[model samples]
Target: MDVSLGTVFVSEIMGTAMLLLLGGGVVANVILPKTKGFNSGWIVITFGWGLGVFAGVYAAYKSGAHLNFAVTIGLLANGAAEYAPGVAVTFASTMVYLAGEMVGAFLGAILVFLAYKKHFDEDADPGTKLAVFSTGPAVRNYGWNFVTEVIGTFVLVFIIIAFGKTPSGLGPLAVALLVVGIGLSLGGPTGYAINPNRDLGPRIAHALLPIKGKGSSDWGYAWVPVLGPIVGGAIAGLVATAYVV
Candidate 1:
C-alpha cells in the first residue's frame, strides 16, 4: 500500500523502537549480572536481534517499515533514478525514518536500563554496563571493525531487497528467519547493526542513562556503524539489480 511520508516516518519510529527494545534487552540480559541470560553467549544476541527485526517489521508494516537507513538509501539508489522527485522524497523519507529510529532506540535503551537497573548497580565493570546498551567490537582495530560491519550489513540489505517484490507481504516467520540466517551465518565478527540509527540511538541512551561508573559511550567508532551500513546496502542494491539478467 502506498503511504505518505508522515505515515512511514511514524512507523519507522514505532518499529525501530521495538527493534531496540528486544535487541538491547537481550544484550542487557546476557551481559548484566543476576539475569537468566547473563553470559548466555553470542547465540542469544544473534537470535534477539533477529527477532527484533521481525517484531519491528510487523509493527511498521502499515506505514511501510523501512526501519534502517541503509535500506532506505539502497532503495533510493536502486529505484529513485527513474523519477526526478524520487531522490528528494527518498532523502527526506530516509532522514525521517532515521530520526524515528533514533527516538525509538533511545526509548528502548531507557526501558532496558529500567529493566536491568539492579543488574547495572550490581555490576562493577563500567565497560560491561555500557556495552549492554550499545555496541563495541571484540577487537578495537578500526579497519576490521569497518570491514566486518560493511560485509554483514551489505549481505543483509542485499538479501532482503533481493528476496523479491517487497511491496508484497512476507510471513512473520519468513522475516524472522531472514535475520536468523543472517545472524547465524554472518554475525560472528561484529554484532550485525545493519541500521545506523539503531546503534547510535541506543548509544545516546546509554550515555544519558544513570549507571554507576559506566565507561565511554565510544562515539569515536560511531560513524562506522552509520556509514558502513549505507555503503554496504548501496553496493548490495546495485549489485543485485545489475545481475538481474
Candidate 2:
C-alpha cells in the first residue's frame, strides 16, 4: 500500500486545499457583509472549522492525513520513521510534505475568495475581510498570543498522538471534535490558529488577491502563528513520545 512521493504531494495538496476552502468559507459566510450566515457568532465558526478538518482528513488519507504541519512536525519530533504506512520519513519527504501543504493552503484561500466573491467585494472593514482569510488576535498581544497558540497546538498534537494509542475507532472525527473544543475554549484570544498553514497560507492569499479594501495582511503578527505552532508541535511530539504515547 505504499504510495509514491507524487501521490503524497498531490494528496496533501488536495486535502489541505479542501481544508482551507471549507474553513475560510465559513468565516466568510459569518463575517462578510450581506451573507446569510453573517454575524452568526463564534459557535458557528468553530463547527465550520471542525467540519473542515473532518473533510480534509478524508481527502488526505493517502498521506495519513497530516494536513496540518504541526501534526507532521510533531510526528517527526517524536522520532518516528514514516509519514504514512509506506512513506519513509526523510529530509526530502519532509520538504515535500511542507511544500504540498503550503501550495494547497494557498490555493484553498483562493477558492474561498472565489466562493465569496460578492461578499469580498462588499463594503466591510478591511480587517473583517482579512479575518475571513486568516486569524488575528482579539487583543493583539504578541507574547500572550504566541503562548495561546503554543498551548493550543500542544494539546492538539499531544492528543493526536495519544489518539493513536487508544482503541476507539472514531479516527478523523475525533480529531475534528478536538478542534471544535479547542476553538470554543482556546480560540477567544488568538482565534486558535494552531496550524501554521491554516493561518500563513491564507494570509498570503489575502495579501496577493485583488479584493476591494482588503487592507493590510497583518504581517506584524504573522510570526506568532507560524513559530508558535512549530514550537508547540515539536514539544508535543517529544512529550507524547516520552510519556503520553
Candidate 3:
C-alpha cells in the first residue's frame, strides 16, 4: 500500500512498455506486409489492445496500474485515497507515472519497429505505417474526431470506475474487456485513441525513427486525441466521484 515514487515509476514504465509493445505490435502485424497477421482486421486489433491492457495492469498492479495518463488523472480526480492507501497521489507521483508512460510508450514503439523492421521496409503506405504508432480519423474531421475521442474515453474511464465498485475484483481482465467493448462499439471514427500517452508517445517514436517511406506524423490532428481524452477523463472522474459518493 505504501509505495515509493521510484517503485511507482518503475512499475508503470514496465507495464506501459508492455502495453504499447503488444498494442503497437498488433497494428504492425495487421498493416505490415509479409507479416503473419497481415490484414487480420479490426477485431484482432481490439483483442490485442485488450490483452495489452490486461498484461499492463497485472504488471503494474502494485502501482494501481494507472498505465494511461488519462486514467491517472481520472483516478486522482475520483479520489485516490479510496483506492490507493498510503500512496500519496501528489504532483511528484503524478509526474512519475506520466514520465514512465511516455518513455515506456516510446520504447514500445521502437520495439515494434525492430520486430517488424523488414516488413516496414516492404510496406509502401505511410498511412499504414503511421497507424501502427498512432491513430488517425477515418474521415479526417477534427470536430467529429474530438467528439468521438471524448465519447470513447468517457466510456472507458466511466466503465473502469464502475468496475472498481464491484466486489468481485475482476481486476485487469474486466478493464481489458471494457477496452474491447469500447473499441468494438466506438472505435470506428478515430481508431479509439482513449489514452493520450498511447497516441503521443508512439507518434513521437514514429517521427524520430528512420523508417523508409514513412509519411507525415499528422501533427495537425494530434491535439484532438490528446485534449479530448483529457476532457472526457476529467468529466468521467468528476461524474464518478459525485455518483459514488
Best by lDDT: 2
Please give the TM-score that candidate 2 achieves against the real structure: 0.97
Please give, for residues 1-245, the per-residue lDDT of candidate 2 as tens digits: 88788998998999899999999999999999999998999999999999998999888888878878888898899887888767888988988889889999999999999999988888999999999888999998999999999999999888888767211223878989999999999999999999999999999999999999878999999999999999999999999888963
List the candidate 3 regions with Cα displacement exceeding 4 Å.
165-170
What digit string (tens of lDDT, one per residue) describes model 3 on residues 41-73? 999999999999899888877777877888877
**Where does model 1 exceed 4 Å of error?**
80-88, 165-171
Q: Judged by lDDT against the true structure, how good is candidate 1?
A: 0.73
Task: List TM-score per model, in order.
Answer: 0.90, 0.97, 0.95
**Candidate 2: misplaced stretches above 4 Å?**
165-170
Q: lDDT of all predictions, in order shown?
A: 0.73, 0.89, 0.85
- Candidate of highest TM-score: 2
Candidate 1: which pairs clash? none
The sequence of per-residue lDDT tens digits that candidate 1 reaches over residues 1-245 is 45666666677778888888898889888888889988998888888887888888888776556667777666666664411122244556667767776777778778878888888889468878877776677777778878877887777667666763241144445666777777788666566677787788888887888887788888898887777888887887787778543
How high is the lDDT of residue 2 in model 2? 89
